[model samples]
Each structure stands twice: as structure tokens, then as C-alpha cells.
Target: MSVPISRLHVSHDAPLLRHVSEHASRTDWCYMHADVASAYHPCFSERLLQQMLQTQERIRRNLAADPDPKAGIHHLVLASDSDVFNLGGDLQLFSRLIRGGQRGRLLEYAQLCVEVAFNLHQLYDDRVHSIAVVEGDALGGGFEAALCCHTIIAEEGAGMGFPEVLFDLFPGMGAYTFLTRRVAPVVAERMMLDARVYPVEELLRMGVVDMVVPRGEGRQAARELIRRNQRIGNALRAMNTVRQACNPVTLDELLKVTNEWVDAAMRLNDRGLKTMERLVRAQQRRAQAAAPALTLV
Candidate 1:
């Protein structure tokens, strides 16, 4: 039986959750667009994280029940509805939690983030592949999220980097692990410490971004890649399996790093918190002004 894409129930109507929609032409492809309420500083809020967990669980159940990988979702693509893919962690929330000395809450948030990243890195199942379509700025945790995908297709002018170092912190959630797996550790360290956004082309040259498409064609490029993979999927999947077997990123590693992140976050001083607050204000201003371009901090 050919399972209809509409029957998968991946589409959601939640206001702050990702707006999922079935690809009209590709029955095996699922699209989840980040439709966050904080469009200016679109970070992974608690609500968004919970929704993502639910959606991934649903997909896992669906895939487990279906014997044929081709019948259901074989590809999951994460994109953004706004101009910026994501501005990274919720700085406003972080500042509040840090000031209140809420280490547990910080850990909880970091855990949720790592869990999502791990699931994406695992692709929910061995049969499915995950992709990220970056059309705009993907900074800090946003960049880390993109790195979790098996394939990252960025559009021209799209920016990616880790700006966490700006406020005396590092992108702790899977940034180091993912980047090391994709590139050299030295390169990854440089990127994290640089605190500057790199154009998609630069990342592509560094072999971080898998493909670069013309502006406004990221989705099309992903679709085309899927079409190509349909023919050699088995081989590609086997290769992915081999790659994982050779160099794996475990949930334990992510969790441990997240713990370290929480500890570091708790140690943020008055100066660091002030920097975070300034960034938060900038995000708010960008939101109010409805800026189309993101100048990554």
C-alpha cells in the first residue's frame, strides 16, 4: 500500500511550533519550517522544543510501523519561515535564568536542545535522512542545529557562525562534536572563537555546507538532491551507516557537554549578562523594525 503523505500527520497548526507541510511532489519528503513567534531573534523556545520532540516521536512511530522506507517519510528537512534561519539560544531567557541562579532550569533547556540535536543527527531512524535548508542567518545554536543534519544546503548570502564567544561563552550544544566530525578540530575551534559570521560560500569552500544554491532556491536544491538520492539511496544510506560506524556522536557525549554548558552559563558575570541583555535588545529592535537582513552578533 502506498501511504499517502497527507496521512502522515506531520503538518501542525501550532502558532509557535514548526509549521510542517508535506511536499506536494515528494511523498517521502517532510518539510518543517521554523515558525517561531520571536521572528527577530528566532531561538528554540521551550514550546518549540516540546513540539519538535512530539513531532519527531510521531515520525519515529510512523517509520517503525512501516516496513517500506519509501512509503513514508524518507527525508526530513528543517527550514525557517522567517528571513533568519535562527538567531540561536534564547538570550533573554538565558539572562533571566542566569540572574535567578536557576542552574537546573538551564540544564533542562540544554538537555532539550541536545535531545533534539541528537534525534536530528540520528535522523529518527536509520532508513531516513535529515537535511537543513539554510536561506538566511544560522548563528550559535542555529548553526549547530544545521550541522546536525546529514546534508546542509544553503542559499547564496546565507550566514552561519557561532557568536556565543562574544559574551564569554561557546556554542556547547553539539557545535564542537558536529564540526569536528565534518571538518578539522582546529577549524572548528577557529570558527567558534572567531565570533564572526561566514557567508555560505565560505562554509561551502570549507566543506561544512554540502551545497550552495542561488538565493531563493534552497528548497528547490534540496528537492533536486532528494530526487537524485532516490536512485542511489541504498548506496548512500550504506555509506552514511559506515560513516556513523567509523565516527559516531553519542547521546552521552552531547548530554555531558550540555552539563558543562549549564555550569558555564551559571558562571556568567555581570559584564557577560549585560552583553547578553544588549544582544536581546538588539533582537527586540530588529523584531520591531521587521528587518529583512540579519546582522549576526
Candidate 2:
């Protein structure tokens, strides 16, 4: 059985939850499900980013306090409570900030996002493994977030892409760096420039998604993977360490890219901003309809 972290009768106080719900698994892992309050947009709002940062910090503190690696969280799985994994950044906020010429606010938001992504990439510590369970669409920054995880287990029929190009912007968070690390640079560039949603099958073939299970089986797949990895925990950890060492994505790199993203965002003309607004409207319509459709280009 799983217990909500907040309700668990433990020695330590539970981490606060607003845009995310966290649970402790009986199988020796932590399960984090994203339940963004802004259903219409379902993006990573400022509050959500802050909450995630706090959650990660708590996890790190716990691991540090316990010298026994087995006593602490072995695997961290991230999934969404809604039909969509995540739609991406707060485009509505982005539009408002850009239109108002609030470049500083935009940079701040981008930096926060980078921090979250960087923390996930490092997995707090090498002993812990991070997995992203994408059971639905993950677009733009959302895709970047998933790519930061050590392993990506997606469900069939799920869609993912970098739709920022549709608004004449690229996914500046970590899409390019993460994708290039997994696949070829040309493939990453094409995916970004194409600006169209790709099916999970195509993503799996392209080496973007690590595993694809049947729809609605994402959690089970993740659990099974976690159990298997746990059996060879030491070996798995060492492999991940080698992987990270071989293809390092430093904090400096992510921050530099975020700076570029801020510059590009400020350069968006009225037409581009209007396109972004249209996408926001489309997201709202999808939310109201209660459909699992990806925003079209």
C-alpha cells in the first residue's frame, strides 16, 4: 500500500503539497504525482516549481541524514495525476511578462525551472535513481523535464514534443542538451524545429523514451523496473554514475541556455505572442472538454 507523505505517521514532518502529491511506496521508492491546480494550462507554474524544489530538498536532506542507502529512497518516480503529463511552461504568464517587457521576471522563472531540472538530472545523489512515467502528452518544457530523469517509461499512445517552435521559440529549458545526450543532435534539432507532437512509439524508436508499455500501465511498468533495478542496486548505481560522468550536463550549461531562452522570448513579436495566446486558449478548451488531446501546431 502507498501512504501519502503528508499523512504518514513518521518521525519527520511531511513536505507540503500543493501542485504535487507525494507518496511513500511499500516497494522502497518515492512516488510523486503531478496534480497542477491550473487544469486549463496544466503547466509548471511558479508555485509548482517552488514546491518541487522544496520536495527535492527534503529528499536530499533525508538521504544525507541516513547513512544506510537502503533505509532511504532508492527510486524516485514522477508521474502526472491528470491525463497529460505536463503541457510545458506557463505560456499565459510568459505572454503577460513578455508583453509587459518584464524580462527580469521571465529570467527568474526560467532560472527556477533550470534548478528543478538540474536537481532531477543529478537525482539529488547518485545512489537514488529517478524515473519519469509519462502516461500522456508531454510538450515543451514538460518534455525537457522528463528527459532529465535517468529513465523514461512512457505509456502507449502518449505524445511528446517541443511545441515552442510553433510560437517561434525553442524549448530552452533543457530539451536540446538532454535530447542530444540521448539521441543524435540532428534528430534533436529536427524534433524541435518540426514543432509537432510525436507518438510514444516514434519516440521510443528515436531513443527518446526508454520504455513503452500499454496505456494505463505506466505505474506498474515503473514499479517492475524499480524492483528489478533494486535487485542489482549497486551495479545499477555504478552504471548511472558512469553514464553521468561520460555525458555530463553541468549547471552552467543549463543556466547559459536559459539566458538564451530569455533573450529569445523578449524578441518575440506581436504575431508570435498572439500565436502563444492562441495555444493557451486551445489548452483551456481542452481542459474544459476533458479531452486528452495535444495542442496542435
Off by over 4 Å in 1: 1-13, 19-40, 69-73, 291-297
Candidate 1 to truth, TM: 0.88
Pick out the ten consecutive residues of candidate 1 with the lowest summed lDDT: 1-10
Question: Which candidate leads in TM-score?
Answer: 1
* Cα lDDT tens digits for candidate 1, 139-255: 899999999988999999989999888899999999999999888999999998999899989999999999999999998898888888777777766776787789977888888
What is the per-residue lDDT of model 2 for residues 1-297, given as tens digits with 9 covering 90 to 100? 011122212222232233332334413233322333343456787766766776777776666676665543467777776678889999999999999999988998898888888877784556777889898899998899999988999999999999998889999999988999888898889998898899999988888899999998998898888768767887866876797788877878888999999999999999999999999999888876763332221
Off by over 4 Å in 2: 1-40, 69-73, 291-297
